[model samples]
Target chain A: MLVTKWVHVPEKAINKPRQIEQDGVKFTQSISPWDLPQQFRFLIDAESLTIEWRYLSDSEPVKRKEFPDGFAVELGKTSSRIYKITVSLSALEKSISVMPTDEAEAATSALIKMKNALAEIENYPNENNKVAMTKTAHWWANLPNKAELLANAM
Target chain B: MLRTSLAVYGWLNWVARGYQRASSYIASSCGFFLLIDTEKSEFLSTRPVITKFVQEIQSNMFILFCLFLFLAVIAHILTKKTSLDVWKEIKFILDRYQEKCFPNNKEKDLHRVTLFRLEKHCLFRRHWSSRNWLNFRGHCRLFSNFLVPVLRSGHINGKSNTFFQVGSDQNYEGVAGLAFRQKSQVAVKNLPDLSSPLMAKVKDRKRLITEYALQTNCKRELIEKWVELGKTVPRSIAATPVEVNGQIWGVLVLDSTSPETLSSESVSDYTVVIAVIGKLLERM
Candidate 1:
């Protein structure tokens, strides 16, 4: 029994919700936290080992596009393996074979630590992450056109 | 987005079909009789023919009325029935949102909530169950707007609670107040303590918790009265507490008119979802 009420929208100020449906992928203005990027890592290749940074730079976004919902756990584990192969192959092309599992573990641990750090940012308005939390909350709360409205068939 | 579009289309289709049906009913109920009456008037001098035509029209009209009554009654009966599990339907939407939020992470839907009795004032009842307070506390108004009716009309969703704490001073004052107490200020207060009754039902911990409304042992008289007075449906519910960092925070209640809303699989899923929320709340 949700009744529809008519409210006038200013001709100039009205911002109809934007729907993205053309790129073989569709997402509404609703944003989910998983869509945001977190986790960071650094690595130094040994004297005989070389690092290939482009594996992440070139492929991760493409992979994300392919699976906008994000990787399933099995897919994530597979992604790590795929990235590892590319890293190994690229490094081998330049005469490096040895890789460290430490970076992945560190990245995960860091992600957890980062979530803990950022989770309370809203409580502390003066904190540096407040701006980020504001943006995040704004993103969540600001999905366009929350009004119960849709096309009415006459 | 697709759901919103489909809902609009579905509603439009329903309305259009109803209109078409009404037109057919009018035609059948009146059009044939009118045509017969006009032809009979033209044969006024022919007594035998007029008499035969009148008999034919009378019998046809009688049959038409019977069909109309039967169809209307059957349609009403069908409309009264519900096939939807509201929580499950909602969870599907939540799952979609969850996937979007943590694309790589799979999370559980909340099934079980811990129940604890509050000492002083209870909005609907004293013992309340919760999973997370963030949803009910912060965005309750939004949920109330979007989800209230959706949950209310569910086949098994008549008694769902998504309550948050609103201390005595803030009765009808804050966000939680507007969400839970907005229905009828007087009616919401003084309801039987939901906790004591539910606590008794779940006392053995040995007998698996089933839907309370269906249990012969549970007294839902007050709750049912409250719903009736509020002009809402009766509810059989599953309420759980939200535990964060080993401390109880809030409650989550999922209820339906029928006691059979939460399946075993859904309960498991709910456990996972609630636990995940508990962790998230601990950080907050």
Candidate 2:
């Protein structure tokens, strides 16, 4: 069965300071819509390998454009913002399906490592000492089982 | 209706009788000898000759009147039928196009243009119209000075009858259909197909879309600022993607609402419609 996963990585690990690249792809934890201060929910389809971005405040969700293969998203200077690198691709595909048994587990582990890296950055008062600190703090805390939730097989 | 028809027929008959009398006088002027034989002068008198001529004249007049009346009625009926058919065709096109443009009941929320210049110019008021160019130029200047900046920068200050001129040389004039972008957001809650099953499964999708669109706008503004050394103020969504020499300068995002009546397929169908709009903009 085709499976999908979402991983969160810290900005420092993937940014110029640490600058880590794996398999021609860079990873980072960006202040994306997924990290908004408000509580949001998403529905995932493992069979089709898709993520449906929905909101609790609103009635419905929208599809985040298919994640770029070689691009990366990292937290911007502002706590409420995210910066994503533009990546060139052959064609626009709806979903990138992977084997559930091996690939899914690896993706989960990668996301957990990124989440831990972000936690270290969040510990430093200087890194987050900005006008939007409270907003960013809540954003980090709401990642429900941040590690385990990366790739739910169902 | 029946009574009126009978009265008209009676009046026509009376007029025909008068015409017969006039014809008889002319026949008599030629002398009674030519009309009757001298031997049977008493039996074939002036009365019988006059009566025959009068009958012939009346019969001809009656036939001609009936033919003219029939033609007039048929012409009137045909004209009415064709006009109604034309109106139906125009209405169908407008309604279908409106659905594609404003699918979410958002059309209802669209405030009417109070500005005289933008109030849906009549077919008669176009440039092709013989109206004075001085008036058109005056309105264009006024719109540029006041409404253009407000709409482009997303500011909402204006009274009733706000107008904006767009395009190089200010060839197009648009009126403020809504008050402000902030208030306009309230109506944007139901964006037709974006909220449908295909999109609804994603969490925080709407927020992401909104933020993404706004961030892109900000980035464009930042680039414009770098070039001009001034806050590259966007005059309006109309000003986005300003083309010069066949190149796209930026992209503009406009807000719309959901009316709930249109099907999801119609929303995706908008790509075709919007593409046509882009082409028209390029031409402009």
Candidate 3:
């Protein structure tokens, strides 16, 4: 099952808790990847066991990476135009990522997501990883140019 | 006297008709009154009285008509004089503003002559406001999404004030936002009271709206966070969208503490000022 939701974060509320509702479930956390205001679309894939977030302005994924049996989280401060966060899902209960002082809260929230996703995967591991990967690849290939379509509509 | 004379003359005419008939009968029977010529006598006697009465009425009517015409001309002149005086003053200020701000047609740097400085030089606040308490605020259109306030001028309690932050931006919200969205001038003679129960009901129980809730459409919670914002919500607001090169570039907003300060009649004057501003911006 694949579900998508849009999240709009208003400007200048750095310390406020953000609530995200996916499908029928709700996730309450203080997860602010970027300090700047932006709108994002979350693609939640249960079969591939991946959560891909894309920026609305330029339909680009933040980042994507694979981890070993333990979930891997990477955090860095880069001078890129857009901020990026890479998280890998596995059965690991711990995260190995340095948290910057200014973004410690956001980093912690990212780690919490990693642990929660890892726990879920452990409980229900994909029976056929090959099939899931093939489906995910096909889904990515068939993705539309949403940003361009939105601009044209406007 | 005229009425009495008219009554007496009418009675005499009636008697003359009867007398003339009797005289004709007598002249035909006895030939004694034939030399009298009753027909001629009757007409000659009544002609002068009728002509004098007509002249008197005509003279009185002519005098009344002339008097009314004279008063109408005087009233028209007085009205024009007052409006012409205001128009002359407005033109003088606008001319002075252009001369002072852009002397010798020298274009100043945009950064050097900021919107605040432009507003100060414009002198519209002093000219438009009867009480000289009008505030002039300027906003620049940003990316077609936001109206960022570049300059805001006003006082609080008869002292210099710094309330709204300089770079705060708004979307389609206030009278200025309405003007920006509509790409035209918008004037509100009196703003509704947002704190009133009627407004709260209209807002669907959103009672926490800001003091600028009605005037500026700013939220109360946001105002609290900003702290110094919207200490004095204006009672009246007038906004004109400034166009540069046929495209809306920004908005010029004027507000006053008293109701009806900035009215629809003032929108034309503001439009003239905004035209000059647009040209100045183009030069810059």
Please tell me which predicted candidate would have the highest lDDT against the true structure: 3
Query: DockQ, per-model, please?
Result: 0.03, 0.01, 0.01
Instruction: Quote each prediction's TM-score.
Output: 0.24, 0.21, 0.27
Candidate 3 lDDT by residue in tens digits, A39-73: 43322222122233232122222333345543343
User: How do the residues A54-127 of candidate 2 rate in per-residue lDDT, one tens digit apiece?
Assistant: 11112112222223343333332322122221222222122334433333333333333333434544444223
Q: Against the true structure, what is model 3's DockQ?
A: 0.01
Please identify model 1 stretches exceeding 4 Å from their true place.
A1-106, A109-116, A119-154, B1-25, B33-165, B168-251, B254-284
The native-contact fraction of candidate 3 is 0.00
Q: Across residues B6-124, which tens digit of lDDT does each residue of candidate 3 receive?
A: 34555655555555445445335433322434335665366876656544544465564576456545444443434234323433444444344334433222101112111212222
For every candidate, what is the interface RMSD in angstroms?
A: 18.9, 18.9, 19.5
Local distance difference test values of all predictions, in order: 0.31, 0.30, 0.38
Q: What TM value does the first chain of each candidate achieve? A: 0.23, 0.27, 0.29
- Clashing residue pairs for model 3: B210-B220
Q: List candidate 2 segments past 4 Å from native.
A: A1-154, B1-87, B96-170, B175-284
Candidate 1 vs candidate 3: the lDDT winner is 3
- lDDT of candidate 2 over B160-186, digit per residue (tens): 222333342433322121111111100
